[model samples]
Target: MRSNFRVALIAGSIVLSQVFAVTASAAPSAHPERSSLVEDIRFKVEKFQLDNGLTVILHEDHSAPIYSYHQWFRVGPRHEDPRRTGLAHFFEHLMFKGTDKYPGKKWERIIQANGGSNNAFTSRDYTGYYEDMPSGTLELIIDIESDRMRNLNMKQDEIDSEREVVKEERRFRVENSIIGAMYEALFSTVFKVHNYRWPVIGSMTHLNATKREEFKAFYDQFYAPNNSVVVVVGAFDSGDAKKWIKKYYGDYKKSEIPAETSKKEPVQRGQRSVTLRRAVQSPTVMVGFQAPKAGHDDAYAFDLLSNILSNGNSSRLYNRLVYREQRATSISSWAYTAQEAGIFNITSELKPGQDVDRSLMSIYGEVYKLRNGLVSEAELEKAKNQVMTDTVNQLRTVSGKARALAAAEIIYGDYSAVFTDLDKYNKVTREQIQNVAKSYLKPEQRSVIRMLPKE
Candidate 1:
């Protein structure tokens, strides 16, 4: 799925693990930076479960005459067996294929006629579907969503068609793109046991060979009401909304959703590197190291460090590699906080004639500075501001609000954490940033992928 919104990863795990099984009804903690502002901004959330095991989280916003209806399934690439992959991504496409009642193109048309826009995304942690529609169309959306969930007509032809689309997607997003190819290689090299090493889109062989029965079996097992959370944010009448939900989804049966526990990767003892010779204008390298899941305290430290390293030309890596030294044309870093242990990535495209080894050494040299000494107070403050800005921007729309609520519930394992994100980041000390850099960014814990220009 192509969309105007969203990119990559399952939300990295942290502060609250899935064991907590959070209900969104709790009050949010105050924002110390501005108590009045945090106190004034609150979401009146209603969290409940239906008899059939459907979990619903509602955030009632009456300022607008529309609602963001999002359903998040706990199934993702991490849930699949090694032999069978990409089924989760397949269902993202399959969900819209429709049941006998609505069937084929009719499903999208109804939403379009109602002045709504809809899209879905699949990640390593979970799969989600959403529709942003006028509040008046709540019942209709509910009825149709229920219909497709219980009565999806899975067909061989449709599966075959979608398979080709997925294969092409792999080509476009992975094989043909330099950054994507490097990441695919980086993750696979870094993770040996965890499915996080397995790309969210899955292996090409699995996509080409997966059968209809296998797809249906996966759907029956994982696509249950018990395995998902439905979020309705924006303007909607909660009273009427609950009624429509029950009328449509009340009687649906819950399936025995499988436990998604997979093997965690064993610790890496030494650096692992993959080198590629490709036809390109410039050589590039992507180095990845293990970082904490979102639930860990260090996850926040990793986030702040990502900013300090590469947020702008003023940051460490950019200032050293791109601007000051002029060893590379570009440089950046990301601390991916997936549900399981995450990855900290630093990628730089070398100046056409620059030395790859030197470029890599320079990248590591700046990281050494962070480990050797604490970042300045100014650097830390700028990182927090950048992070806080990104968080606020995500909530600029009702759809973004629903997405955040869904991620908080499913990805963070606690919806209330969404409210305290600023508090968490603000609490991260410079020492913590240095400590995480020392702990996780060791060369032994790293996996590097270098792409060289072909002869």
Candidate 2:
């Protein structure tokens, strides 16, 4: 349900490709634009645990004949043993390698017969599996998922095969892309002790070093039914889905999950900087400011600040850096919206021969002005409207709703948060937004990265 969140500067190139032209809606907005705090936007959510402790949530949406099956596990790089940096993401690939009961071919046959597609991803906080299929094929989807969850076919040979595959994935994604290389270097230098510094795709060296026994150990520790959430969305009888889930998943036993007792990162005392050299035509600059978690009150204000500075062509950074100043081919900012503590970042790709230092200073000037003065009421209104419009539009498709439900439930711990969380954005004021900028966007709390063309 969550968006693919990379570092702000790097994510800009990809996010920009998704033409997010937020045109104002013409018809009267049926629902109240303002969030109604007391009224929970409850779907027909029924929760149950199988005999083995797998948590299942069923929400019946009969808008169409298709269904989305989403499964989320409470493990990610954050939960990995310090030495096991990419284990979570590595396991994400292994999960699809076919189980004993559902070998790769058999699993594909069922999915192909049912007109469904499936994929999985791993993040810092969680890993997720999802399938979109015809509503009538619920049983096939359930069977495949249950089999893999309990009985994975982890062989030494298969692990070796997937490790090479994952290595090439890292090469393609991190080694090839200019910005991706920059992020790998940036995070490596940025977080001295936090697990957050490790790339989610994992290191090729670590992936190769991971033993098959390690995979089994990881599965036993975190892949229990109790530590996972099953999300079913689309046209279906809720009662029927629940019965099928219990029958298929009930026998799995939940073990006592191990606690994650990693070293907590101490507050950073000073600014840090790093440089990356890539064989690219243009240079790029990135600035990351440590910010609050997604649940914090100030987070909403920071989200608004991100939009005001770089959400669109009309945003301040876009206008200043790319349009007026003509220093950058593009400029953007993002509040790394995460459930855990995250980064507020700005990125700019320099126009040929542009002064990087001057461009960086200009960007700083924009932040200084915001911290010193209130954003205009009109600007605040536009940002709020943009957030509302985007939220409503995301639910326009069944697959999108399913993704939203899975993400909200797994990350925020509440599916109802899809609607309730909007309140934070609605209630943000100009002064509060300015105050947050001043509080969190200080030089001492930030990191700077510059990627230059290889000399």
**Which residues of candidate 1, in runs, are more than 4 Å off?**
1-40
Give per-model TM-scores. 0.92, 0.92
Per-residue lDDT tens digits for candidate 1, residues 309-378, read 8877788888888888898888877777777777888889998888999889988888788888999988
Instruction: Please write out the lDDT profile of model 2 over residues 1-455, one tens digit for every residue.
Output: 11235311111111111123465772112233545632433355666667776777777788789989988888888788777678888888788878888887788788888788888877677888889898788887888888888788987888888888888988988898777776676665556676777888777777778788888999988888888988888888887888889888888888678876645555667988888887777889988777776567887787778878887788888888888988999887776545566667788899877787899899889988898999888788877666656566655656666666666666667766665656666778998998998888877777889988888
Please state the error at residue 409 of candidate 1 in Å: 0.7
* Whole-model lDDT values for every prediction: 0.78, 0.73
User: How does candidate 2 fare on TM-score?
Assistant: 0.92
Question: Candidate 2: lDDT over CA atoms?
Answer: 0.73
In candidate 1, list every pair of residues with a backbone clash.
12-294, 12-337, 12-338, 13-293, 13-294, 13-295, 14-294, 14-295, 15-295
